[model samples]
Target: MDQDGRDQNFSAASQVNGDHVEVVVTGEVDMSTADALFRAATPDGVHCATLDLSAVTFFDSAAIHAVIRLADRYPGALEVRPSPQVLRVLEISGLAGQPWLKPPS
Candidate 1:
């Protein structure tokens, strides 16, 4: 799909509470959608960012890198609520249970 088509299928929204921001993401998170997810999860000046990926259906290395970059930008400030698929990716990438990652319950 084209960029517009991919964007229409994948969406991210953030809700800020005090110094924390919860970013809710829905749809596939591949190379085409990773940037938008990263942007939504890593907003400027937010002390903490919580990425809610409960609705995410697919993800790849691009999505993993996006999360890694976000963690690099703000260490110990990112909480990730991963879907089962995303959780598998994180586990395989050796990012699960890291200080920067909050695995799904």
Candidate 2:
């Protein structure tokens, strides 16, 4: 699919609450959509305090890289709840137990 077409399969939204922002993401998370995920998770140069990816259906290494970069940018300041799909990729990458990652709620 074209970039626009691929983009349509993914979405990320950020909600600010007090001192932190919660970023919610859904749909396929591949190379084509990882950038958008990063942008939504980090707004105004601040990494989001929480990442909600429970609705993500297709997760890839690119998405893992994006998430890792986000965590690296803020260390313990970030927490992520991942979908099973995202979790699988994290497990394969040996990043599933990282402190910043949490099981889905």
Candidate 3:
């Protein structure tokens, strides 16, 4: 959680389900916090990664770029759960149709 009473800041916590890892992220993801986001998503021994950003309140281009880079680095191993805000950014950036960024149901 952040001092400003926002949803937890850009941090990742994980749980293992059989062979997969689900990384739930909450809070804002921006230029200043992209490294943390990247590191959290690319932990060791993770064969499958899901980034859940439903609680995220904000996202910037840096976050989007980081997501793209991470996906490119890991290819089929990465899944992104972007919040509506994050999804909007991807849609505006022309990245919504990317294979790694599936629309929320």
The numbered model that scores best in TM-score is: 2
All candidates' TM-scores? 0.86, 0.88, 0.81
Candidate 3 global lDDT = 0.78
Q: Name the regions of candidate 3 deviating beyond 4 angstroms.
A: 1-8, 16-19
Model 1: per-residue Cα lDDT over 1-105, one tens digit each: 564566666889998888788989998999988998888876667888888888888989999989888888778888788889888888888778778656655
Residue-by-residue lDDT tens digits, candidate 2, 63-98: 988998988877889998999888888898999789
- Clashing residue pairs in candidate 1 are none
* Best of the candidates, lDDT: 2
Badly placed stretches (over 4 Å) of model 1 are 2-5
Task: List pairs with backbone clashes in candidate 2.
Answer: none
Ordered from best to worst TM-score, the candidate numbers read 2, 1, 3
TM-score of 3: 0.81
Local lDDT at 10 for model 1 = 80
RMSD of 3: 3.2
lDDT of 3 by residue, 3-29 (tens): 764334567677777656777878788
Off by more than 4 A, model 2: 1-6, 45-48
lDDT of each: 0.83, 0.84, 0.78
